[model samples]
Target: MGACPCGTGRDYDDCCGPLHAGVPAADAQALMRSRYSAYVREDADYLLRSWHRSTRPHALAFDEPRPAWLRLEVLRHVATGPDSAEVEFVARYRIGGGSVVRMRERSRFLREDGNWFYLDAVGG
Candidate 1:
């Protein structure tokens, strides 16, 4: 369960610690990846923590049916500035019946107080 591409060597905590602690990522791309990891792991805390307050929901529940996350692929990343960035990626997964599901999204981020927060989602 410790393998995560977000570069958090000791699972989500040791790797995306700052990101989950409300510390903005140094760039947009980093934030996007960390959020993806959060979803795959069902780490609602991390998701809520990284969401921009203006758009963040009151609560995030991940206790529903679970999906078997297969792989994460970061297709492209573009940074306009320290405070703004976009990432396009695909997250693949599988559930019952050997079915495979893929989620693709172009994510946006904003930097605040030296941390990156997920601002919004574009396409999926």
Candidate 2:
């Protein structure tokens, strides 16, 4: 099996695969990593399902010429509250024949019941 797209250096099945297969993530960080893996796999359904209803869009659509996601570097993961957390990461990608672009964001997540959901970007 190939390495997981989340840069975990582990087989997909051992890493993000189970999360994609309907298993609940153990923590907010796992959910964040799985969300990145979902983007790499182009799994819009999983993304939407994992998103907080308050900020989730009606749908998710990849750009016409999808960007080639290269790598992910998680810079920080902090538990802001008993049921809230934030993860800051840098993701590099390249659009059709374009130079790689590095995008960074600090995303917030909240746990409702026992499932973690992505809330929104913390800051620009």
Candidate 3:
């Protein structure tokens, strides 16, 4: 298998693949990386499953003209509280041969029942 889309320099099976396959992520940062990999793979089910129920969308639509994920750069991961955390990352992608676009976001996550779920993003 190729390198993990999260840029973790590991095979997908040893990295985010397991998370997408139903294994819970160990931390907020790990969940965030796995989410990025889900997007790269167009795995909407994984994305939805990792989202917090309170804020989860009804559905995820990877419509046409979707950007092809190129790389992920995790900037920082910090615990805001005992069960809350934040992950800041820059994801680079391009749409249909267009120039690369960088999306920088500080995403919040919550842990419930020992499972990490993405809450929302603060800035992008």
Model 2, residue 17: C-alpha shift (Å): 0.6
Q: Candidate 3: deviation at residue 64, Å?
A: 1.0
| C-alpha RMSD values across all candidates | 2.7, 0.9, 0.7
Per-model clash counts, in order, read 5, 0, 0
lDDT of 2 at 6: 96
Order the numbered candidates by lDDT, best leading: 3, 2, 1
**Model 1 over residues 1-124: C-alpha lDDT tens digits?**
4567554345666566557666657677778777877777688988888899989999998654677777777888888685688888888877755778888998888878777788888996
- lDDT tens digits by residue: candidate 3, 55-89: 99999999998999999999999999999999999
Q: Which is the better candidate, 1 or 2, if ranked by TM-score?
A: 2
Prediction 2 TM-score vs. true: 0.96
What lDDT score belongs to each candidate, Candidate 1 first? 0.76, 0.94, 0.96
How far is 38's C-alpha from truth in model 2 (Å)?
0.5
Model 1 misplacement above 4 A: 5-14, 21-24
lDDT preference between candidates 1 and 3, better one: 3
Off by over 4 Å in 2: none
